[model samples]
Every structure is written in structure tokens, then in C-alpha cells.
Target: MRILVTGGAGFIGGHLAERFVIDGHDVVVLDNFDPFYDTRIKAHTVERCRERAAGGDGSYRLVEGDVRDADVVAELVEEVDYVYHQAAQAGVRPSVEDPRKYDDVNVDGTLNVLDAARDTGIERVVLASSSSVYGKPRYLPYDEDHPTTPVSPYGASKLAAERYACSYSEVYDLPAVALRYFTVYGPRMRPNMAISNFVSRCLDAESPVVYGDGTQTRDFTYVEDVVEANVTLLAEDAADGEAVNVGSTDNIEIRTLAEEIRDQLAPDLTLEYEERHDADADHTHADISKANDLIGYEPTTTIREGVWKFTEWYRNDRDWYEPLVLNS
Candidate 1:
């Protein structure tokens, strides 16, 4: 199979591209190497993909392009069996500052992917949606039917993208599924996320900052499981025109997460609390029953175990992860 992963240089995309290569699928990674973080991480991802393909029957190609370019996206879609659209401008606060950029990258960019996939007759298109679309949870463990009242532009963009995928599937008979990811965390994750910030601060012998009195809870899904969810959709057609939640079995409080990472890396450091950022969700927990029933998906890693794995990976890659901003 020939697979195309947009934003394949980023964390989850990188991991997914590598896995596809290992599975002996010829893979093409489409990315613009957006300097949201250091571009070195993306270079490293491409290197890892090369390593995966070197001794296998698979091939890897990295195309330096933007998804907003319809011509580039069309050409790439024509050569692939499946499309995993992971490219986007990610972050709540940043999107609040610049909503139009978010719209251009997340909404318009997604339209390009879906349009190309429709024209090329791709097997399936898996969109990377976010739990942020649920807004301040109406109830615990948000279901797929939860009303999407996103407070931030980032969340609104994701909701728009996912809905477009669903609409494409329905109107154009294009096979597509949108997975609403919940606080995904693992090696090489976005440096501005909560887990990364906590781990980085703890490693530097500084207090792990907690926002909003440390009571906010998040369902931190492991990257591997998120990858599995996408891979499962490659062969399953029952979920076409649907949006499903991809998340862990449980939620952990921000304070608890900070404490756990601190205990693992730097027990001497205490936690620090700051006022919550504007447009941030109060809490998020996903009801993945739709994913389970539709695609037989299940989260395999717990938060505690995942935190350990992330800390270990960060320790090794600490030298290269040059995050642009601190206290994100």
C-alpha cells in the first residue's frame, strides 16, 4: 500500500509514518516544516523513517510542501492509497491570538486534502480532530453527540475540518473518518503541551506550573494507540462519514499529572500554579464507545505508564528539542 501522511514531520504524524514504513508500505510524508518548534525534530523524523525503510520492502519520501496548495496536494493524493491529514496550526492560545492563520491551515488546508482525495478516489481519509471541539464539557466523558461549542479558534477549526470530512463522505461518497483526539502525548510531542511543559520543567529542577488551581483533568492518549486507531480505519469501511472519539480509559487531573512527572524526574521540585489561559477548556474526557463499536479501538496505555515513557524519551532527546517558547 502507498500511504500519504500530511504533517508527517510532527510527533504523531512522524510515529504514524514510521509505523507504516515498518509495515512494508511505501509512504510519502507531506510537510512544510512549519517552525512551530525546532525543525530539527522533523529532520530527525525523516531520518527515522529512512531507517525504517532501509532494511525493509518499503520506501519513504519526504515532500516539502504545504497542504493549502491544491496542486501539490492533488499530485500527492494521486499517488497514495490512503490519506492521513495531520497537518494543522495547533494550540489554543496561539489560535486565539491569530484565528485567521488557524482557519487557513486547519480548515482550508483540510478542504484541499478532502477535495484531492475525492478526485483521486483514495481508499480512505482519516482526519486528526481534537477533543477541544467539545468546549467546556457539558458532562463528563464527552460523547460524539456532544454539542461542539468550542471556545477557542483552534477548536472551532478542528470541528470545521472534521465536519467537512464527514460531509465529503456523505455528499461525494468519499470514504472518510474523523478521530477526535484527546490530549495526545508521547515522545516528540508538541513542546507547548501540558505534559511536555511539566516534564521539561521537572527535568530542569524547576516547579511544574499548573494552570487554574490545578483541578483541570485531561484524557492523555498515547501516541501509539492514536496511531492504531488511524491504522484500523485503513481497512474498515463501517465508520465512513462518521467522527469518533479517540482517548484513554480514564482522565487525570493536571495537578496529579504534574506531581507524577515531578516524582519520576525531580522529586525535589514543587508544583507552581498560574491563572488559566484564556479560551482553554475547563476539562475534557472522551467517550470512545463510538470508536470501540465502529472500529474495535481501545487505549492500551495508562497515564502513569505513558508519563514514564515520555520522560525517558525526553531524557534522550533533550538536546535536540529546541522549543521556541517557555511556559506555553
Candidate 2:
């Protein structure tokens, strides 16, 4: 199999690219190395991919480019059997500050990927959607049928991008499936995420800050589970043109999660709180039954376990990666 992973040098994209190569599938990664997060983090992921390819039967190649460039996207899509569109401007708070940038990258960049895949005989294009599309949920454990009233520009852009994917699947006979992800975290995750921040602060002997009274809940999915969901979709056809939840099917309160990370190193450390951002949702839980039915997806990592695993990785990684994250 030949696979093309956009944003393949970031967290999830890097995992997918390396996994595909390890499974003996030729993989090509396309990323602009956007400074949205630290470029050094992305550089490290690219190096990981290269090292994985060094001993594997499959080959890995990276093309440094932007998805917004139609010519670049079309060229890359033409070379792959499958497409994993994972590139986008991420972050809710930042989106609040600059909505148009989100629109241009999340919306227009996605349009470029979908449009390029239209006639490329691509087997499947897996779109990385988000649970944020379901604003202030009408009910708990949001199903595929939940209303998509995004509260932030980031969510709105994801919703629009996924809608375009569905339209292309319907009108252009494109095979695309949108996976609406809950809060995803794991090794090499963005440093600004709550888990990352909490773990970092605890390591530095600082208080873990939780905004908005710390009562909110989140269905945090581990990166490995999300990678499995995408890989499973490679052989399944039942979910084409549909949005399915890729989550752990469980949730945790913000304060509880913060404490869990804090206790790993600073059992006596106290948690701090502040007013929550308006764009933040009070809670998020996913009904992953649809994903199970469509692609045999079942999350194996619990929040407690995931947090512990992340903390362990951070303890070792921060020695080298922290300086880059801080400098960047």
C-alpha cells in the first residue's frame, strides 16, 4: 500500500506515517512545518519517521509543503493509494483570537485536499474531524446524530471541512470518512494541551492550572487508539461519507485529570483555577458504538492509564524536547 499523510510530521500524523511504514507500506508525508506549534517537535517526529524507515521493508519519504498549495497537494495525492488528511490550524483559544486564519487553513486547506483527491483514484481519504463540532451538547455521550453548532471558529472550520468531504463523497464519488475525535493526547502531543501543561507544571514544581471551576469533563482519547481507528478504516467500507466518533468511550473531570498528573511528582501540589474561555465546552463524551459497528474500533486505553503513560514519557522527553518547546 502507498499512503500519503498530510501533517505527517505532527503528533497523530507522525504516528500514522510511522505505523504504515512499520506495516510494510510505502508512505509519503507532506507537511509545511507550520509554526502553529514548535517546528522542532515536528522536526523530531520527521526524524522518528526516518529512523523507523531505516530498518523497515517499506520506505518513508517526506515533502515539506503546504496543503494550501493545490499543485503540491495534487502531486502528493497522485502518488498514494490512501490519503490521511490530518493537517489543520489547531487550538480553540487561538482560533478565538484569529478566526480567519482558521478558515483559510482548516477550511480552504481541506478543500484543496478534497478537490485534489476527487479524480485521483484514491482508495479512501480519512478526514480528521473533531468533537468540538458538537457545541454545548444537547445530551451526554454525543452520537453521530448530535447537532453541530460549533462554539468556536476552530470547531466551525472543522465542521465546514468535514461537510465538504461529505459533499465530495456524494457528488464526486469520492471515498471519504470523517472521524470526529475527542480530546486526543499522547507522546509528542502539542505542549499547550491541558495534559501537557499540567504534567509540565508539575515537573517544574508549579501548580497545575485548571480554568472554569474545574468541573468540566472531557472524553480524552489516546493517540494509539485514534491511529488504530484510522488503520482499521483502511479495509472497511461501511463508514464512507459518515462521521464517526473516535474516542475512549469514557470521560474524566478536568480537576481530577489535573490532580492525577500532579500527584505523579508533586503529591502535595495544589491545583489553580481561573475563568474558563467562552469557546470551551462544559463537557464532552462520545458514543463510539458507531465506530465499533463500522470499523471494529474499540479504545483500549483509559484516561487514568493514558495520563500515567504520558507522564512517564514526558519525564524522559522533557530533558531534550523541553528546551525546544520553550525556545520555539
Candidate 3:
């Protein structure tokens, strides 16, 4: 199989690209290496993929480009069998500061990918959507049918991208699947994320900041499971034009998660509570029934287990840590 992964140098995208190549597929990664996080972190992600490619029998390639560039997208779409569109401007707090950049990258970039897929006759597209699209869910486990009332520009832009994928599937006969990834963590988590931020603070023995009384819950999914779900979708016939929730049904409170990290990584660390952050949701849990039915997707990591795993990786993977910004 020939696979084209947009944002292939990103946290999740890099992992996904590595998995595809390891499975004997020819892989091409397209990423602009946007300064969303430290470019060094993104560069390290690509370096990890390069290591995998060096170790594997299958061939791999990386193209430094943005998905918003229609010409670049179309050129790459012409070379691959399946298109995994994972590139987007990420993070909620950052989106609040600059919403137009989110719209341009997440919304317009998705449109570009879809149009290129249509023009090139790519059969399948797997989009990395987000649980933020569900907003404050009225129910416990958010199903694929959950109403999408996005609270942040980042979520809104992602929802728009998913809609575009579905629309293209209908109009251009391009089969597409959108997976709403919930609170994904583990190796290569973006530095701006709560887990990464908290871990960095803990490493320095600084009191980690907590928002909203730390009672908010999240359905944190591990990155390996997310990669497996994407791969499973490629072989499943039932996923066409489907939106699946890629998450464990389990939920963990923010305080419990933080304490677990502290105990595992820095036993003496304490948390500093702050006023609730804007654009932050109270809770998120996913109903994976659709994913299970379509792609046999099931999360293999619990919150406690995942936190330990991520902490271990964070401590060992100093190359991913931004030295200049440390304690800044």
C-alpha cells in the first residue's frame, strides 16, 4: 500500500507514519513543520520516523510542505493510495488567541486535501478529528451522533473539516472516515498540552498549575491505540463516510491524573490551583461502539497505566524537550 500522511512530522502524525511504514507500506509524509510548538520537537518527531524507516524494509519519504497549498497537496495525492489527513493548527488556548490561523489551516487546509483527493482519485481519507467538537456533552459517553456545538475555534475548524470530508465523499465518491480523537497522550504529546506542561513543571519541582478545581474529567486515549485504529480502518469495509470516536470509555478526573503523574515521576511535587481557564471543557468521554463495529477499535491503555508510560517516555526522551523554553 502507498500511504500519504499530512502533518507526518507532528506528534500523532509522526507516530502514524512510522506505523504504516513498519507494516510494509510505502509511506510519504507531507508537513510544513509549522512553528506550532518548538520546531525542534517537530524535527525530533521526523527523526524518530527516519529511525524507523532506517530499521524497516519498506521505503519512506518526507516532503516539507503545508496541506493548505493546493498544488502541493494535489501533487502528493497523486502518488499515494490512502490519504491520512492529520495536519492542523492544534490546541484550544492557542486557538483562542488566534482563531483565523486555525480556520485557515484546519478548515482551508482540509478543503485543499479533499479537493486534491477528489482530483487524484484517492479512494480513502482518514481525518484526525477531535472530541472538542462535541463541546459540553449532555450525555456521559459521546457517540458519533452527538450534536456538534464546538466551544472553541479549534474545535469548530475541525468540525468544518470533518463536514468537508463527508461532503466530498458524497459528491466526489471519495470514501472518507473521520475519527474524533479524545485527549490523546503518550510519547510525543505536544508541549502545550496539560500533561506535557504539568510534566515539565514537575521535572523542575515547580508547582504545576491546575484549572477549575481539578474536578474536570477526560477520556485520555493513548497514541498507539489511535494509530492502530487508523490502520484498522484501512482494512474495514464498514467505515466509509463514517465518523468514529477513538477513545476508551473510561474517564479520569484531572486531579487524580495529576497526582498519579506526580507519584510516578516526582513524588514530592504539589499543584497550584488557578482560576478556571477560558475555552476549557469540564469533561469528555467517548462511546466507541461505532469504532468497534466498524474497525474493531478498543483502547488498550488505562489512565493510570498511560500516565506512567508517558512519564517514563518524557523523562527518557529529552531530545523532544525544548531546552531554550524550559522553565521559561
* Alpha carbon lDDT of each predicted model: 0.90, 0.91, 0.85
Q: Tell me the tens digit of each residue's lDDT in model 2 across 1-328.
A: 9999999998999999989989989999999898888888888888888888899898999999998899999999998889999999999989999999999998999999998899789999999999999998999899989999999999999999999999899999999999999999999988778888888888888898899888899999999999999998789989999888999988999998888888877899999998889999899999999999889999999998898898888878888766654443
lDDT of 3 by residue, 181-223 (tens): 9999878777767787777778877767778799999999989
Find the candidate with the highest lDDT and give its number.
Answer: 2
Rank by lDDT (best first): 2, 1, 3
* Candidate with the larger TM-score of 1 and 2: 2
lDDT of 2 at 277: 91
TM-score of each: 0.97, 0.97, 0.95
- Location of the lowest summed lDDT over 10 successive residues in candidate 2: 319-328
Model 2, C-alpha of 224: deviation from truth (Å): 0.3
The residue pairs that clash in candidate 1, if any, are none
Cα lDDT tens digits, model 1, 10-58, are 9889999999999999999999999877777788889989998998988
Sort order, TM-score high to low: 2, 1, 3
Model 2 ranges with Cα > 4 A deviation: 324-328
Lowest summed lDDT window (length 10), candidate 3: 319-328
Q: Which ten residues in a row have the lowest lDDT in candidate 1?
A: 319-328
TM match of model 2 to true structure: 0.97
